[model samples]
Every structure is written in structure tokens, then in C-alpha cells.
Target chain A: MDKVLRDKKAICVFVLPAFLFFFAMVIIPIFMSGYYSLLDWNGMSKGIFVGLRNYIDLFTSYNNEFAKSLGNSLILAGLSVFIQLPISLTLALILARGIKGEKFYRTVYFIPVIISTVVIGQLWSKVYHYEYGIVNMFLRNFGLENLVRDWLGDKGTALICVFIVIVWQYIGYHMLLMYSSAKSIPEDLYEAAKIDGASELTTAFKITIPLMKPILNVCVTYAIVGSLKTFDLIWVLTGGGPLKSTEVPSTLMYNTIFFKNQFGYGSAMALFIVIECLVLTVVVQKIFKSESYL
Target chain B: MKRISKKLLCLFAALSLTLSIGGCKTTDGTDGGTTSPDGGSKDKPTLKIWHITASDAEGNRTILLNAIKEAEEKFNVKIEETGTENEQYKTKIKSAMAGNSGPDIFFTWAAGFSQPFVDGGKVLNLDPYIGAVKDKLLTGITDNFTYDGKVYGVPYQMQVGPLFCNTELFEKYNVKIPETYEELLTAVKVFKENGVTPLICGAKDVWPAMWYYDVLALRTAGSQLCNDALAGKASFESQEFIDAAKKLVELTEAGAFGPNTMSVSWDNANVDFAQGKGAMLFNGNWVTGNVNAESSAVKGKIVARKFPLIEGGKGTATEYFGGAGDGYMINSATKDPKLAADVLFFLCEKLAFDMYEQNTGLPGWNVSVDESKINPLTKEISDMTKDSTGWTLWWDVFLEGAAADTHKNLVVQLMAGEITPEKFGQEMQKLNAK
Candidate 1:
């Protein structure tokens, strides 16, 4: 097998079809988007090459809402990193310790990850509904009717509500990754730590966590990229509305392209998303690069 | 044997992958349906139709389906139909038409939505095909589909955003149906005090909220100024436009749509209104169907009327707030214009009749619908429309592309009371300048 792999002709034959498929499906469309971003097109009408005007408008246009959407996505990323990952880490640590019902908890937590995002989005939309949602209902039952408000409708609460749902829906996914990473630690290490009278917390902080750096890096990158690309849940719930307080870049691109028919401007926004995700992924990988060697 | 099995498995994987990838090509939607092999169909060509309603949506889709079934047999051609969800359909149809791959007969939204297609020469001029049906259509219903005195499409549905009031809610709250501006304020005040939402609009969709503002702008500035301002010939910063914005904001401030308008969808608002949760709904005549639907809670308790004339405003109650905006046009690239036009015209007449009978909308065609058999709300609304001196199309439909979306967004903001009335005018003026 290794000798065959060393044959360049065999390698080319094996990889050519998949590479051609990727080039056609992924790379060509991206380049087409780039080319289209330079033209002022309305899908059906003739396009004039406007050259960087669309890109300039994507940032500066008042109604475009691209910058604000980016900020919303960044805020979601921050919350995912600060809140979601910590909770995932804690749960993974506890479960990896071989506690009773560990398998049950692991499987149950991961069920949300396996479920469709649309279902989760709808489930949370109901959970946050002002009239019949569990959140408001719980508040009402506790004699806090004054605090009840439309969670997904109010601009003040909408972004946080969406963030909570998105951050929540993926906790099990990141936890599963971290849990498997934690579980892979040699049993001898734990035994040695136990003989050394090291507390579980100390071992977790010093050895387990340090050893899990590579997986942590993967989780952080996934969280940030996922946050940027979080479209379906937000689209399903608020549609970037209640004054567009919950607008994300993806939703803004969708609205601009589909509703406004500003195909060129929307292409610029799409290209920006690709660049944004790519840059953030690089930054995240760089941040974790040194420690990934652990 | 094991080596042979391994080679066979590898071959199958490659074959399947290639097949799947090749299958990704979009079908023009003409190939899939089971053709009648035993019938005399060797000479029968296929005519493809596209519509906005999803296959699962009951009301309009069913009517369209029935019409297609009838048209197929009558026209003696196989019909290929594709249904797309509304907003997605806009993008799909636009791109498909531009690429010259669109269905022969596709549903086209009237006015500014079809303007690009008409200008791009993608749509066939239907005047030749529609001449026989032209005189049968109600006067002024074909105005939106007529560009430069040539009809590019034909309309089958009509609506004027009428104010639907629930008599049951009004009686329960002891609030009279407001017939004038001052009485409207009083009813709003009373309804709020009695814990009933006075005016209900689903701001979630943004278009419904825009209807509220359109009617207000019409009442404040009259159709002439509204037309001029909307056309950018007159400034939206005019006092009348500001006052219109002020009136819209005033209604929201008075708790007209209630606090959750932005959260509820138009369909949900209809459901809620039917369930007696709101006292009034300013919506299209389509709401009549919802009110008369089998599960409606306000079946017999509903009545629709012209929006009350605002005091000292230029708009008259005779100037209604809707026109023929939904329509269908044939692709210019169709191989057989005569066949497509036949199917289109037949489906349209059937559609108009069904829509009127089902209370889905007012008919654009001059169908003799039985008044007593239709929803009483429809009769009352249509009877009230007999007084209409003029009709103003939905502002969103009248405005082109981004301006259309901007107008709706601005109206939503106005309805939300987030922008001052003056600010709304200024922002609107910005769009007008564009």
C-alpha cells in the first residue's frame, strides 16, 4: 500500500475525482461570488462593474446591518467560549471521572447535539415565548409577572435569548469532544496522582487540562466558527428582527440577497463571511498553536 | 473470491459517488411526473408552471392544483408544476428567469416585483392572449400588470387592506366600531382599558405593519400625495407624511397593536384575532377566509369596513388601500406561447372564481360569485368597496427591490415607536432620494 501511494500516477488517479468535485462545487462558487461582488446586479437586470463599491457599502450602508451583525456573532462567540465551553469542560471532567450513571449522563447530554437544529430552534422559540413559553411561565408562577416580556421579540432580550439557545444546543457537542479527550488520559497518570495524594481538582487543573489543550483548541475554533455561521436557529427564531437587534451576518446576507435583491452587495457580504471565518479560524489556531504540542 | 468482492465494492463506491454528484444538477421540473403512456399523448407537449405556495399549504395551493388539473385536460397537454415557498420563490424565479431556465408559466408578483423581469425582456406580452379575458376583468384590476400600455401579466387576486373588527370583542368591551378619526381614538382608548388590543398587525412579517402605515399615509396625505411621495416626485418630509408617521406612532403609543406585534407572525395574528384576542385587524381581505375557516372562533362575529377617515386629512375613505398585486406571466423563452397562454388564462379564471368563492381574495376577473354563499365578510367588504374612488397598491409592492424592503423596515420601525415620526419621515425621504 505504501509503495502504491508513493506512485504519483496512482495518487493522482485516486485523488483527481474528489479534487475536481471540490474545485467545481466549492472553489468555483466562491470565486464566482467574488466576481459577482464587484458588479451592481439585481439578479435579473444587467450588471455594471462597480468595483469595491459593494464592499464599501457592506460596511458603511446604514440599512445593510453587516457590521452590527458581525458584532452580534462575535458576542455569541465570546459567550460560547466563556460560558458554553466552561460548562462543557466541567461536565466532561465530572463524567470522565467514572462516576455512577456516567454513560447515561453522557448519552442524554449528547442527545441535543444529535437532534436537528430546526427542532431545537423551535423548541427554544416556544421556551422563550412571552405568552406560553416555559421561561415566562416559570416567572409568572413565581409571582414575577412584572418581569415577563417577549423574549424573542424585544430587541433588548432577543440577542441574548438566541445566544442562550445556540450556546445551549452545542454544549453537548463540545462536551462530548472534551469528554473523549479527557477519557483518553492514561490510567497510570490518575493512579500516580492518586498515590501522590493529589486532589481531583488539582489533577484536573495541572495534568488533565494541560493534556487536553489540543482538544480545547479544537473546541474553541469550532465554537467561534460555529457562532459566525449560526444562521438557521437565528433565522428560524427572530429572522434578525425586533429592529434587527439580533441580526447576524448570515441573516443579513440572506435578507439582502433574497428580499432586497441586491445580489452583488449580498455576494460581498458572503465573501466577507468566508474571509471572516477563515481569519478567525487562523487566529484561534495560532493562539492554541504553542500549547497544542502538549 | 474475497479479492473479487473487494474490487466490486470499490467499483460500487466510485459509481455511486459519481452518480450522486452528477445528480446534483437542478432539474427544470419537467421530467419527473408519470406520463400517460396509454393515452394519445405522443403529440402532447409539457407546460411547466411555478407558483409561490408550498405543496403543503392548503388554501391557494389547492386552488392552483385544481386549476392545473382542469387546465391539463382542457388544453390536452401534460402540466409540470413546481411549488416554492414564498420568499424563496422570489429569488428562485428571479434567478431562473435571468438564466432563461424558468418554467414556461410562472407566478409573478405584480408591480415593482415584475418590473425588472419586464424590463429584462424575460416575460411574454400577454395582451394578445388576454384580449378576450381583458374586457371581462374588473376595471383597474389590470393596471399593475400593464407596463407602457402593454400587459405583461394577468391578475387573478385582489385585496384592499380593510379594517376587520370583531363585533363580539367590541360588544364584550362595549367599544363601538370607530367610523371617524376621533371615534377611533376613543375606541382605541376604551379597548386598551378593557384589556383588548385595539389594532392588531403582525409586525413580525413587516409587510402587515407596512399596510397599517400605507393606509395611514393615504388617509393623511390622500392617494395623490401618497403616490407623488412614493414616486419620489414629492418629499416624504412634507407635513402630511410626518403627520402620517405621527398617526402610526400614535396608534402604537396608544397600544394599538399591543406589545407583542413584532413577535407574532401574520398567520399567528390571524389565528389570535380569530380566537378573539384582538378587537380589530387592519389586513387584506384574505383574512375573511381565516375568519370563516372551520376552526375560527370569530366566524359570525366579524365585520369589515373602510378604514375610518382621519380628521382634517386629505385622504378620502373612498380611496381604498389595495389593488391587484398577485399575478402570473409567461416566460418569453417558452417554446409554445399559445399553449402556455391557454393554461395561464384558464388557470387565472378558475383561480379568480375559486378565490372569490373561498373568500381567499376579491376577484380580479368579473366572476359572478354568489354573494350569500360567500363569506358575509367578503360581501360586506366588497359592498363597501363599491364606494372606492381609487385604489392604491400595497406600498411595498409599488416600490422596487431595496426601496421596497426599506419601506417595510421603516414602517416597522414607525410601528415599533422606535423612531420619532419626524425621523421616520427623514428616513423615508432618504429612501425616496434613492
Candidate 2:
């Protein structure tokens, strides 16, 4: 049995099925997308090979708005890293201290992660509704009527409002990752810090955070990648509308491919998203690796 | 190492077995229904139908279902039907048809929306089937669905865009129903002075905003120029198109719509108008059904009329921005084209009468209706459209491919003051050129 386990043929046999599945599902489709990106085909007909014209149009055409969509995705990613993760980390630190009803609080924080994104999107859309929405209603109730504006309608506020909801919906997911990693930290370290007269905040920064570096890196990568690919919630909430203020790559791809019948152009947008995600993910890993070495 | 390898092998075996069984179960479930093996007796062919009229209470869902039931009995065939929401139905049908796996019959909008399917040779030319019901349909109604002198779809309903007014609100505010574009502006001023929203149009969906642009363009440039521009023969930057855009901007500046027009959804805009929160709504005739629904606040008080004529515009007061749009077409790749056509013909004829009686829409087919049973708003629309000099299809439906998207997005931006009328026209022409 040991001999069989050590054999390269056995390793190949074990890995082949999973590799084949991955190749079929992931690799082939990407190559197909790349091939389709060079054609000027509606999804229905035989494609005319345009030779990177779709890619050229995606960047140079004034009407495409691909750059604007990429910028929106990057903003979402930046917000997730800077705004969403800190809030998650704070909650995880507080909960890891074994405060009262810790388990209950943890469950409550994790609830949104389990709920369907469509349900969350609908829930947020109502909350941002112009007239009767809770946000406006609360503003009016406080005699701040002038402060009331269309949260999801105004071009200035639509993207921000959507980002807030997205940050809120996934806050629990990141919190859970941090919490479990914090739990695995030895209690003796806390005792050692406490004996040295270190405060809770200091211990959290100096010990818990440093100890949770690996999990934090994982959470950061997840947050950034997830942010770059956000579709379902945004699709339901604004449909990338109110003058396309909330337009992102995924929604743009969907509209161009399905509604406009520019499958080749949409494929170019899809390929750009994939490359953007891949490059950014590697950059994030390199940053984390350098930080760990430091 | 041996123990670990054993455990991994067991897990792998379990996973493969589970996946294979799951696959088998799905295939078995689907095959269980139609595997009768009596060769002598002919098995009933299942006619698969897809439609967008899935709304339970009103729309054409009930009418279509009833027609399907009748056809199933009359033709002695099994009818399988799937109804999806309007927006989702487009993507579903297009992808399915593209994959050559679409239903035998499916609902579609006429003209530019269906042109791709026709061009791709994915739609059956219905000339052979229309001989029986050609006289039954309204004259020129089939023109929207015709391409290259061949009718590819059968029209069931005629939708005309109308400006729906809450008569109670008009009376309360003592504002007259507008007769011309200037009068409409005066009404807007009066309503705004009274602290009422003159018109409640939800621009969030973008298409709702297009209704305003469509009528303004129709009245300013007339149907000929609009169609020419859509066909790329005329430029969107023409003086007439720019004037139409300017008029729309003027209306927007005068606060014709609700303050949060861009935020409210299409359904909510109708609800606001129905609840007397707004004085009027400019939308498709489908709003009549929503307004006349039993629970609507302004049920008996709503009135429908064509868009008021623009002063000194080329279009007449009778011109409208709509036509016979929604209809059903047979998939070219269907195994039984004749059978699908038969089902489509039967369903459309029955639907026409059902739709008229239910006040869901104006029937495209020439069907007699008991006038008393029809909703007053629907009747008002029918009467108003009797002498319409011309009808222009919705711009989004009239313009194909990327041009349609550009038109819709530009209209939204124009409404939001993000682009001037001149810039809007230029952008439209640039997109059209592509």
C-alpha cells in the first residue's frame, strides 16, 4: 500500500479526474472566450473573425464605457479592503475576547453570509427606496428633510449606496474567518501579555493581529476578488442604472452579450475582467508574502 | 501513508458514485414521462411553448393558458408551457434559440427585436400558416413582424403608449386635460404650483424614460424621420431629432416628473399614479390594467389619451408611439413546424378575444367585444387609437443591437441632465454609425 501511494502513476491516477473536471469547466471556457473575443458574432450566427477589433473597440470606443466599469470595480475592491475588512476585524476581535453571548453574536453576524444575495439585494433596494424607504423616512423623522435624497437614484450617491450594502452583506463572512483564526490562538499568549500589563487593544494589535496574519491575508484576497466579481446584488438593486452610474464589468457584459447581441465585444469585456482579477490577486499575494518576510 | 491512501481512495470512490447516481437520477426522472412502448398507437407530441406573460392576475398569462388548454383538447396533443418575467424571458429565449434548443413556439416583440432571429434563419416564415387567419387580423398589423415580404410571427395584441391621467387629481387641482404641448407645460406648472408631481415616470429601468423621448421624437420629427433614423438612413443629429431632445429637456426642467423619477421603478411609478400621488403617467397601455385592477386607488377615475401634439411639429395629434408589438413565432428548428404553427394560430386567435374582454390590451386580431365588459380606460384607449394617423414602435424595440442600448442609455443621460440635446444627438449618430 505504501509503495502504491508513493508511485507517480498512482498520483497521476488520483489527480487526473479532478484535473479533467477543472480543465473542462475552467480552462476550456476561458480559451473559448479568448477565441470568441476576436469575432464579430451575435450569439446566434456564424462568427466573422475581426482579429482583436473587439478588444480595440473595448478600450478605444467612446461608447463602450469599459474603462468606467473597470474603475467602478476597482473602487468597490478598494472599499472592501479599506472599509469592509476593518469593521470585520474589529467585530472578530471583540467577539474573540469571549464577551457575553459570544456564540449568539457570532451566529447573528454570520447570518447575512448564509442568506441569498437576491433576498439581500431586494431588502436593500427597499431600504434605499426614495419616498418610503427607511433611509429617507428616518431622515424626515429627525426633521432633516433637506438631507433626504434618492440614495439609489442620484448619480452621485448610487454607487456609494450600492457599495455600502455590498460591504454590509459580506461583513459577516470576513468576520467569521477572522474569529475562527483568533480562536485558534493560544490563551497563554494573552496571559503572557496580561502579566506584562499590556492593554486589550495593545495585545490585540501586538499579538492577535500578528498571529492571525495568514488568515487575514486569505480574507483580504477573498474580499478583493469577491468585490471585483460582484454581480447578483448589483444586478437586482440598480441593474447598473440611474444613468449607468453603477455599471460594472459583469452587468455590462450581460447587457452587451444578451440584450445588444454583441457577443464578441462582451467576450472581450469578460476576458479583461478575468485578467484584471488574476493580476490583482497575484499582486495581493506578493504584497502579503513581502509583509510576512518583514 | 497506507492509511491515508486508503481513506483518500474511499472518499474518491464515494464522490464518483454519488455523482454518477445523481446524473442517472436526473436522466431517469426526465425519461420516465414519455417512454411508452406501444408502437402501434401514435404517441402525442409535446408542444413546448415559452412566453413572457407570466404575471398571474392580469397580463396575457391567463389568456395564453386558456388558449393552450383549448388547443391541447382540440389538437389532441400535450402542451408544455413555461412563463418567465418579461426581461428574463428575452435572455432565456435568445440563448435557447441560439443553442438550437428553444421551445417549439415562443413569444417575441416585432420588428428589430425579432429581426436577428429571422436573419439568423432561426425563425420559421409563417406565410404558409397565416393564410387561414390573415383576414382575421387588423390590416397592416402584421407589418411589424414582417421581414423581406414574409410574415415570421402572428400578432395577438396592439400596445399604444398613452398619457394616463388621474381625473380626480385634475379636478382637485382644477387643471384642464392638456390638448397640445404648450397646454401640457401649463398643466405641469399648475400641478407643480399645487405641490403635486405632474408626471411620475420611473427612469430607473431606462425604458420608461424612452416613452417620453419616443413621443417627443414622433411629434417633432414625424414617423418617417424616426424610422429613417432607426434604419441609419437619416442621422439622429438632424434638426428634428435635436428639437425633440430639447423639448424633452424642457419638460424635465419644468419638473414634469416626480422628484425621484430616476429612483422609482416602473411598477412603483404606476402605483404612485394610481394612488393619486401623481397627476399623470406616460407609459404603455399595460398601465391601464394596473390602474383598473380592483385594488387600485384611482380605478374609476383614470383616463387614457394619446400624447398631446407638440406645437409646430411635423406629427399630427393622432400620431402615436406604438404598434402591434408582442406576438408569437415558431422556432425554425422545431421537429414539428406545422404542429407548432397550428398551436400558435389557435393560441393567438383565442388570445385576441380574451385580451379584449379582459382589458389586458387591444386585440391585434379583428375580434368583436361586448363594450360594457371592457374597462373604461381600455375602451378610451381603443377609441383614441381608432383614427391614429401613424404609429411608431418603441425606439428600444425599433432599433436593433448596440444602437438600441446606446439610444436607451442616452435617453437616461439626457433625462438626468448628463448630456445636452445636441450632444445626445451626436452620440446617437456615432453609435448608429457603428
* C-alpha lDDT (0 to 100) for residue B193 of candidate 2: 86
- Give candidate 1 misplaced runs (Cα > 4 Å): A1-3, A292-294, B1-40, B55-57
Top candidate, metric DockQ = 1
In order, what lDDT does every prediction score? 0.86, 0.86
lDDT of 1 by residue, A67-140 (tens): 88999999999999999999999999999999999999999999989999889887888898768899999999
Regions of model 2 farther than 4 Å from truth = A1-20, A141-143, B1-42
Considering the two chains of model 2, state its CAPRI-style docking category: medium
Task: Give lDDT tens digits, candidate 2, residues B1-434.
Answer: 87678767855875785577568656754442232233323687777788887878646677788889999989878887888998889998888887677778889988888888998899999998789888998998998898999999998889998888889989988889997899999999999989899988888888888889888999999988888888789999998899999999999999998678887878778788878889988888888877877778988898887788887889887788889887999888677778779889889989989999988888898999899998888888999899977878998887786778788889989988999999999998986777
**lDDT, candidate 1, residue A195?**
97
lDDT of 1 by residue, B3-83 (tens): 557555655676677666667643424332222233446788777788987856468888888999999889888887899
Local error of candidate 1 at residue A28 (angstroms) = 0.8
List clashing residue pairs in candidate 1.
none
